[model samples]
Every structure is written in structure tokens, then in C-alpha cells.
Target chain A: MKTTETPAPPPAEPGASVSEVAAPVAGPPRRKKEGAVLNVFSHGVLVIWAIMVVTPLLWAVMTSFKDDSSIFGSPWALPDRLHFGNWARAWTEANMSGYFLNTVLVVGGSLIGTLVLGSMAAYVLARFDFPGNRFIYYLFIGGMSFPIMLALVPLFYVVNNMGLLNTIHGLILVYIAYSLPFTVFFLTAFFRTLPTSVAEAAFVDGASHTRTFFQIMLPMAKPGLISVGIFNFLGQWNQYMLPTVLNTDPDKKVLTQGLVQLAVSQGYKGDWSGLFAGLVMAMLPVLGAYIIFQRQVVQGLTAGALK
Target chain B: MQHGKYRFIVGFLAVPLGLYALFVVWPFIQSIYYSFTDWTGLSPEFKMVGFDNYKRMLHDDIFWKSLQHSLLFALVLPIVTISLALFFAFMINVGGRRRRGGPAITGVRGSSFYKIVYFFPQVLSIAIVALLFQFAYNPDSGAINSFLRGIGLGHVQPLWLGDPSLALWCVMAVLVWSTTGFFVVLFSAGMASIPGELYEAALIDGASRATTFFRITLPLLWDTVQSGWVYMGILALGAESFAVVQIMTTGPGGPDYSTTVLVLYVYQKAFRDGQAAYATTIGVALLVVTLAFAAIVMRLGRRERLEF
Candidate 1:
């Protein structure tokens, strides 16, 4: 708010070399005869790995376009004609719509609750020296390593006791609760890295803490919020274990569970094309979101790990 | 002012704290308590059977087998995935040779392209990956066998996930395939953090690529690598191990329990077999082993971290 935003000055530490801070990437090294060979070798390996990552999805898509006979005939050939019916059959007959809707409601609700609650908690912990702040922070950190399976039997009953079993609300509450650790973990660290001067100015302007946070600080923390938001969106959207154990009604099943059931049934009944369609249906939205936020996906996963 | 500060803190903190306590922290405490009882999942009433479940676990062959699978997964997953992750990340970040006293090295020719492509599988739910692989592994029409036969190798094409002998390894291969990209991205970030001057200094000293990786990159990225190790290691034993198996395998564990992991065993017992107490018993043991494995790895992963 004070100075012109010219890419904010580099960190104020000595020996923070211009190249190290500014251009962390380096150019080509000095003479090394074997480097060309190594580059080829690296490309060879990466290309093969890339193919490994890609082929299955491609295979599934292509297979989805083919009927049973074509898929069974030539694994490598293009479909004689695209079969859009498989996708329609999957969306309607497989009950994927109901599941997709349930997932949308649960994940959408969980994301909002998690961001609001997590940011509030993160803000307080980052800004104030409250009693038990360290303890509360560690309490959240401690949940990160604890296996979800270890807590399953008891968590089942906890949700049940709260009368939230077999409901979207229950799933949302649990998702928000478990996601708190990760959400708080990243946001707390992120909040700490922000300059406190902005919030101080807000406070001096006669704003309440709530007003300061919602109007000033939260927006300043937008990049952090987005990173963690992207992280949570993918995670809760893909969440399987908690939802599987928690949300069990056939109509109430999330997309992952529904897709699993559809896949298993399709396999048993030999609806291979329909199975492929179901897989694609379950995959497209998440894939679209991932593509849009590809940079954030990389940033969030790495930061989440290191943090 | 003091009173207002306290109120502000409580106002901000109350909801998250209450929910965390109820859902995350409390379940852990309850699981420890539940492990000793004989409570079926549905029954409110049960008798306390002290250490009986643990005793049963000692004689339980399936329990032992599941643990072995988890141990095997924990061992093999990091060796294969992390090694590949480090290699790819190193190549992406430092494989290119650069001019002296110039900007940092470029990644491989198409680094961002490769990264996005590599990380494609990551966004999908594990169930989607599992199902995709399951179809790909189907002996009759699946991609693996079909491709193998198409390429003039019909005689050696094995039933991948269906064969009892190959089932477990096939499942682990899926885990590796789906997970490796994230680690690659992780290691690349760590690689990016290593300043340009160190590589230049090392180049001046004539360090080979392998030597630079093992000597410079690996040591500097040790801590970041350790957490990733702990993560990949614990995944071997987590409920996630169940998701793949449950989605991909024939039975819950399939082909005579070949792909059964500890978490699957717990899920089966608690959910299918209705042995909630015994499942919690297994869950407790899993908790101990996972934490211990993580602790031991982190302890060993500690080195005199370079502070450049």
C-alpha cells in the first residue's frame, strides 16, 4: 500500500546474491563433451516415463469410443466411429449424476467451511501470542501423520453419534474438520510470511479485528489462500476413504464411490465401453480443474510437502 | 484491551478448535481405548477383553501376511519411486549445461510440458486410477496383455492383477505410477532452491553429473527428501492402500488375499466382518508401526544439513 509495486524488493539478507535471488535458474555450463549424450539419455528416459503416464488415459478414452468388439479386436486402432451412447448410458444408467451432484454439494460445502474456519484460526495464531497457540498448532500438525485408517472405527461412531451418518452434511463436516490440519498448516505459515504492516494500518483506521481480517488481511493473503484452496479443492474432491466409510447410501455416494461401483458392475457385466465412459465422466471435471491450476498444483504439492 | 484481545482470539479460534477436537483428535484417543474391547460396530454394549485382540493378532496368519505386504510395499515403494523422482527432478532442473557466470540452467527442453503431462494422473481420485489400471490389466481385453500380444510377445503375457503371484506387485506398480509425478515435482522444487553458484563452483571443480547429484543435490535436499520418504512410506500402510485394492482386485483382497494390506484387513474386519474392536486392535498396531517407521526413517535421514 505504501510503495510502488515493482516486484517487491528482494530479501534483505547479506550474500543474497543477485543471481541466486533474481535468476535462480542458470544457463548452459562450460565445456563438457559427455553432456550431449547425457541430455539424450535424460530425454529418452523422460519420454518413456511420460508415455507411461499418458498411455493408460489415452487407452481408456479410445477404448471408450469403441464398442466391445473393437476394443477386444485391435487395442491400438482408432474407433470405427465414436460411440457417444456409452457416455450417456454411464451418466444416466450408472447413476453417476446423482453421485456427481452429491460430490459437488459435499465438496463445495467442505471447501467453503474449511477456508473460512482455517483462515480464521490461521490468522489468530499467526498474529497473536495467545496462550496454547504453539500447542494448538502442533495439535493440528500431529494429525497430518496419523493414518486415517487408525481413526476409522472411532470416527465412524463419532459421526454417527452426531446424527450425521449417511448424509452430505456429515461428510462436509468431517471433510472440513480433517482438512483443518492441512489448511491451517499451510495458511499459518503463509500468514507468517506476510508483512504485518497492512493489518496494522487497518487497525489504526478504527477497524475491528474482524473488519481488518476480512477487508484487508485476507485479500493480502490471496495467493496463499488460492494455493491452499487449490490444494483442498483437489483433495476433497478426490477424497475416498472418509467418504467411503462415512457416506454409504447408494443414492448418497460421492463420485469416487459411485464410479467404483459402476466400474465393478461394468466389469462384471462386461460393459467395458460404459466403464471407460464412467471413468472419463468421473475424471473430466477434476482434469479440467487441474489443467487450469497446473502451476498451483505444482506449487501447492511441493509447498505442502516442505512446509 | 487485554480482555478484548482474549475475546478476539477466542472468537476466531473457537469453531476450528471444537471441530478438530471432536473429529480428528478425539477419534485417535477413542481408537486407543476401543482396541481393548469386544465391541461389534453396531452394538453399544460390549465386554472388555484386555489384550485379547492383540493376542489373536499374534496367531493371525492373515494379519501377518497383510503386515508383510505393507512392509514389502514400504520397502520397495521409496526405493523405486524416490529414485526415479530424484532422477527426473534432477534432469528437469540441472540436466542442461550452462555458460560460465550466466543465469541458472534451463530444465530439459520441454520441462513444463513434461511436468504437466507427468502430473496428469495425480488429479484423478485413486478410485479412477485404480479402475483405469484394472481395465488396463484385464487379461482378455486390457491394454497390457493386448499390447504385449500385439507386439509379438504373446507367450510371455501374464495375467497381471488376476494372477495370485503377480497381483500384489501389480497393485504396487499402480501405486508407484500414480504417485511418482508428485515426488518429481517435489524434488524439482527442492532442486530449484539450490542456488546457482554452488553448481557453478562444482562445475569449476569438474564434478560429473552423477557426482554433482549424489554429492551436492542429494545432501542439500536431504530434509525435503526425508519428509517425502516418510510420506511415501506411510502410504504403504494407510487406508489408501485399501482404496486401490478394493477398487482393482477381484475379491476385497483378491486371488486368496494376495493384495491384502493392513488397512484393508482392518477395513474388512471392521466393516465386513463386523469386528470393530479387533479392527481397532489392528488399527492401533498399524498406528504404532507407521509412526515407528516414520520416526526411524526421519531419525536416520538427519544429516548435518548444509547451510549455504
Candidate 2:
């Protein structure tokens, strides 16, 4: 994926040099000719994979527009007409609007909280040569391997004790805790990559650690921050397990759990179309984010995963 | 000045550290403590169980079966997903060559499209994924059987999620499909950073494509592969079975507990069966298994950092 971003091709070989190589036993010419054919075959394979991957999603969208009968009767056919109202009904009838708002609140609050807290911790870890810095960093990174399910029983206890069950705030707090490790790990790498000169300059001036982080370091780390935010947003938005186990009240449900309820209620009755519609509706926010933040999210996933 | 710097560092570190301690660390400690005590989730009445839960867990067949399922998932998932991802990533990476008057075939036909397509499952909620697959794997009118019947392989269609023997494999297939794209994107990026000259040099030396791939590509790509392996292993241990069990299967894992995984059993024991302490013991068992798997993978598969 990153290879596609390089615009300049490798410097072209001189024409005479290419022709000199081409004169030998039809070797160079044959290789060059075969290269073209190989490229074509490569594209063919990719195109086929793309079609296979996209078909299910296309089926989903098409099914969303069909009535219940047409969905099974003509699975591959286009909707007789685009029932735009399924989307509308999905929103209003399913109370997807409330779920959407809950998702945004949960994702947004978690994103902001994760970035602020995670970046601050990353800054201290990366910049200061403090005692136990490595230990603290390890502590955060170790949290990465701690299964949320391990904490599930205890998390319920803690949240229930705090009277946070079913509240968006409770979900937000859990999201923050769950998200912190990756965010800190990624941001620490990002901060370390920053030329030390910038932070050193800030230190030489009267800028305090907090001021340097917020003013100079944060702006410089925009790409990293944006990438991390998009990753966290996707994680929180598509989240199912946390919300399912945390918030039981339908009114407090996020899009994920709401879609589950919609499926359970509608699926057995052969309401596949409605279920698909709800699925499509639930996918919109992440789809929008993907379209907007495609490059950064890919970069973040690459960098964070590889590190 | 030294005292002031110490104060400043302490102040900067306090909030996040405090939250982590309270929410993450303290809970971990409390979980360990709770595993040894008898406490129902709802009521305050409790007793010191004194390793009773763990001792019972040792003899419980279900507990062992769940552990085996989780271990099986962790072992198999990375191998299947990573191999497929590597293949796809290589295809997409090398696929795009400039053709006459096209808008840079890379974006339209190359890694970007692969990125988006593969990431579709990642963006959808797991509930949606499970439900979608539930219909896809439906015994009577599901897409898989329909496609099989449409082709000449009409006799080969199996009840995917319905058959106990096939259900676990069916769930694993969905997991592989959903996650392989994520690894493909990651591996492709890792592949991209390798200098093009290296491949050219190998080609110039009369190395076949297979030789170049095995010798140059796989060795250099080991770090990304290991990272994906460890991460997937941890997730496999924790949530892979939990998510599918919660969504698609019945309690105690499904179809005579063929799909019962450790976390789900813990969930059932804690919430459904009202055996909180026993369930906590199951969770601790899982925690131990995950840590052990992670440690082994990290130690054995550790690769030197790629400079590029």
C-alpha cells in the first residue's frame, strides 16, 4: 500500500544502455515483453479479489433497498427501485438517531480523553529521563496484553459500584482505559521520531513541559494525532463487547448493540432486508471516517502494527 | 531547580497514572483477590474460598475444553490469516504498473482499494458481522449453500454454523476473513518500505521470483508478521471466542459446547450461573494462558529490527 504512494518511478535507464542489453539472444526484449504480460495478470488477480471482497457489501446495500420478498427471491438482482425510505425508516423507526448520538459521544469522548491522557504520558516518557520511565512505559504497554474479558467481571463490579452502568460516561471511561495502551505506544514512537531540537528549543525558552507539549509538540505531531484519533474512533465506534457487557439499557445502546437487537428481533421473522438496512445505517459513521481519513488511518495502522 | 523539576514531573504524570492505577491496575489486583474469595456479583455476602475455585477448575472438563478451544484458536488463526495476508499484500503491492493514459492504476486498482475492501469487516461491528455470517451460513437459504448449488458442487454444501463438527471451523473462517485484511494492509506497508533496489538486485542475479520472495521478502517482513501474530494471539485468547459465542452460539458454547471458549465459560459462570468467584478463577486461568502464549511467541519469534 505504501508503495503506491511513491510518485517518481526509479530513474529511467539511458536509452543506449537499454538497447545494448536488448541485443543479446532476444533475452532483454523477451523479459521486457513478459513483464508487461505479468503486470496484466497481476491486475487481473487484484481485480478479481476486489470483486469478491466487495460483493458481500454490495449485496448488503442492494438487499437494504429490497422488500423482504424480493431479497430472497432475487438475491442478485438490483432493487426494483431504490427504496430510500429504508434508510429513513431505519433511522426513525429503529431509533438509530439516539444510538448514533450515543456512538458519537462515546467515540468522541474516548478519542479526546485518550489523546490527551495518552499523549501526555507519551510525552513524559519520551522526553524526560525520569526514574521508572521505562517501567511506566512497560506498564502501559503491558496493558496491551491484558484481556478486557479478564477484567470483565471486575469491570462490572467497579462500574456498578460507581453507579456508571448504562451511562455513556461509564462506557467512555472504559473506552479510555482500553484505548490508552495503543495510543500511548503509538504516540510515544511518534514523539520519539520528532527531532529532539524542537522540544529542546522549547525547554531552553521558558516553556514548561505542559506548555511545550500543547503548543509546539502537539501541533508538530498532527499527523500522528490525527491517525491515532481515527484509529481510536474506529475502535470505539465498531465496539460491541464493551458496550454489550456495560450498557444493558436499550436507551443507552450504541449502534453495534442496537444493530444486534434489530437483528435478533427482525432476523428470525425473515426480515433480512430490515436487518441489512440497520447494518448499513450502523456502518455510515465509520465509512465516512474511512473516506476522510483513509491515508492517515492506513499509515497509523502500518506504523503502530509494525512497531 | 531540581526539586521544582521533580515536582513538575510528578504533576504531569499524576492524572493519567492515577486513572490507570484505579481503573486498570487496581482491578487486576482486585481480580486476583476475588479469584480466591467467594463473592456473588450482586450481593455483599461472601466467604474466603481459599483456592477452592481453582481446585474445582482443575477438575472441570468444561474449563479444560474451553482452554483447548482458545489455545487452538490462537495457534491456528495467525498461521492462516498471516499467510493469506502476505499473499494478498504481495499481489497488491506488485500489481500496479503504469498503463497508457490511466489515472495511476495504483489508486484505482492497487493497495488503496485492497485497503478499503479488506477493512470493511473491521469497520462493521462484530454483532453485524456475526449476524451477517449467520445468514450467510444459514443451512437452508444461506448464500454459501446457494452458491454451491449454483455451481456443480451441489452435494458438498455443509451446515456451516448449524453442524457441531463444522460450526467451530465456520466461526474460524469468519474470523479469518474479517481479520486477514487488517494484516494484509499492515504487511503491504511493511513490504513497501523495503528498498526496490534489493528486489532488482535479486532479479539481476537470476534469482527466480520464488527464491527472491523466500530469501529476501519473508525474512525482512518477519517483524510485521510477528507483531500481527502476537496481537492476534492475545485477541484470540481473550475475545475471539467471546464475541462469536455471545452473538451466534448458545450459552456454554453451542451445539453441546463444541464452541465453548474460556472467556465465554467465565461469562456464563459469573453472570448467568451466579458463580462469580468460580468465573473469576476461569478469567485468571485465561489471563495466565494468554501471558504464557504471548511470552513464548515474543521469545521464539523475536526478529531483529529492519533498518529500512
Task: For each candidate, report its DockQ versus the true two-chain complex.
Answer: 0.37, 0.34
Among the numbered candidates, top TM-score falls to 1
* TM-score list, all predictions: 0.92, 0.88
- Candidate 1, residues B1-308: lDDT per residue as tens digits? 23378888999999999999999899889888888998998889988899998999999999988898888988898888899899999888888656446464567656787788878877888888988888678787767776677657678667888799999988988888988998998888888889988987887787888988988899988988888999898877785688898888888787888988889888899989999999999998888889998988877766345332
Model 2 residue B205 CA deviation in Å = 2.1
Give me the candidate number with maximum DockQ: 1
lDDT of 2 at B180: 80
**What is the per-residue lDDT of model 2 for residues B152-249, given as tens digits with 9 covering 90 to 100?**
66787787767888777777877876788788788888888887778767767866555766778888888788888998898777766577667876
Quote the RMSD, in angstroms, for model 2: 6.6
DockQ-based class of model 1:
acceptable
Q: For candidate 2, give the lDDT.
A: 0.76
Please give the lDDT score at residue B297 for candidate 2.
83
Candidate 2 interface CA RMSD, Å: 5.3
TM-score of chain A of each: 0.86, 0.84
